[model samples]
Target chain A: EPEVTQTPSHQVTQMGQEVILRCVPISNHLYFYWYRQILGQKVEFLVSFYNNEISEKSEIFDDQFSVERPDGSNFTLKIRSTKLEDSAMYFCASSEALGGYEQYFGPGTRLTVT
Target chain B: DQQVKQNSPSLSVQEGRISILNCDYTNSMFDYFLWYKKYPAEGPTFLISISSIKDKNEDGRFTVFLNKSAKHLSLHIVPSQPGDSAVYFCAAKLGGYGNKLVFGAGTILRVKS
Candidate 1:
């Protein structure tokens, strides 16, 4: 079974530095998404991407955050400046279609900002 | 946003027994519900899902029951095994082309052998 895969399973960066979390979604899926879970918190949606554009984003996905599908398979989330609170497990997910389709998730990248 | 709620923080069940995980959602517009299983150091794996148009959906030993009237759903794993132990998250999504999923805090299930 094909699965979503992410790079840099664990990332550590300075508080003011930048970080890019990369994901290669399932090849045939059309919609991609990013979600995060702060320790002990529920997984929260960050943004959704389709057709090389952002479909929707949450308040947490402010100016500091941006997503790009620079290539056919690569979907990346970049944080312009990391804050201590930004440390969390960032996950990437994709679905073949919207509405009733189930989104498949990647193993996640654990981003740690000190 | 508290749209989806999984009241139980954890559950323990003996091997070969049935494990029932419950979830609730306050949003009536949410037309789709899904359950995901997660192991340590891994992302959530899609387990099963049900649409609002149906009351139940099953695959193998896993069964999902939805009560639209009460806005509640449950995942039942029969004949549970130790490997089934993991954190289960209940997620809800509105019916649309690009709607995002709202996840609950997740319930930790331990299926002891």
Candidate 2:
């Protein structure tokens, strides 16, 4: 079965540096989302993207965060400046439709900021 | 937070036994519920889901039961096998488009052979 895939499975960056996490969602899926899980914490929603615009975002998705669908298959989350608290496992997900459909998730990129 | 809650931290069941995982939610606006399985170093994999309009949904050995009145749901795995061991997460979402999913702390299951 086709699955969502992410690049740079593990990323290490210095605090205050910019970083980009990339994802290639299931080809035919229309809606894309980004979520993160700090160690020993529940997965938290970051933002949702559709039609090249942000549909929804959480407080954690502040000015420092931005998402882009620069190409047909690539969806990326860029953090303008990384903070120690930003270190987490960032996941990308996509669904064929909203509401009742289940979103498929990628293996996730582990971001570590020091 | 705290919209979704999985009270159990871990569970162990003997092979071929029944395993039940329970979840509770505090948000009534959530109209959809889903269960996901995750292994180490991997992302969550969708297992099954049930809409608020339905009380139950079944697929293979897995059956999801929803009690809308009590704001609770449970996932039952019958004849559990060792391969079924993993961390299970319960998630909820609103009914409309672009709504974010609220996830509970996952419950770890160990199906021993």
Candidate 3:
């Protein structure tokens, strides 16, 4: 089965530095999303992208966070400036169709800030 | 306002027993519900899903029952095996396009032999 692929399984970044988390969703998927989970916390939705534009975003997805489909198959989430609170596992998900309930997720990128 | 809530932190069951995980929701606008399973250090894997219009959906040993009136849902795993142990999460999609998924805290299931 094809699955979403994320790069840099684990990242160690400095505070106030920029970090880009990359994901290559399933080749035929049309919708993509980014979600984060703090340690021992529930998964929180951050943003969703489609057709090269943001479809929906949460309050957690503020000015510092940006998502771009830099290419046809790759989706990227960029954090303008890392903060201590930015430390978490960021997951990327994709679906074959819109308005569908099932979304396959990637292994996730664990961002650790020191 | 957290929409989806899973009150149980963990559940342990004997092998070949029934394991039930429950969830509650505060939002009525959610039309779709999904359950996911996660092993340590891995992303969540989709388990089963139920729509607001249906009260039950089943697959293999897993069965999801949705109670629209009570704003509750439950996932039942019968004849549970050791491999069935994992953290289970119940997620909801607000409406119109699965844009975002609001997730619950999750329940850790341990099936012991």
Residue A1 in model 1: lDDT:
92
Q: What CA RMSD would you report for each candidate?
A: 0.9, 0.9, 1.0
Model with the higher lDDT, candidate 2 or 3? 2
Q: Candidate 2 on B1-112: residue-level lDDT in tens?
A: 8899999999999999999999999989998899999999999999999999999999999999999999999999998999999999999987666768999999999999
Q: Report model 3's chain A TM-score.
A: 0.97
Residue pairs of candidate 1 with colliding backbone atoms: none
TM-score of each: 0.98, 0.98, 0.98
The 10-residue segment with the lowest total lDDT in model 3 chain B: B92-101
Ranking the candidates on TM-score from highest down gives 2, 1, 3
Q: Residues A38-72, candidate 2, lDDT per residue (tens digit)? A: 99999999998888899889999999999999999
lDDT of each: 0.95, 0.95, 0.93
lDDT of candidate 3 over A43-78, digit per residue (tens):
999988877888899999999999998878889999
Worst 10-residue lDDT window, candidate 1 chain A: A94-103
Query: Alpha-carbon error at B101 in model 2, in Å?
Result: 0.5
Q: Lowest-lDDT window of 10 residues in candidate 3 chain A? A: A94-103
TM-score of 2: 0.98
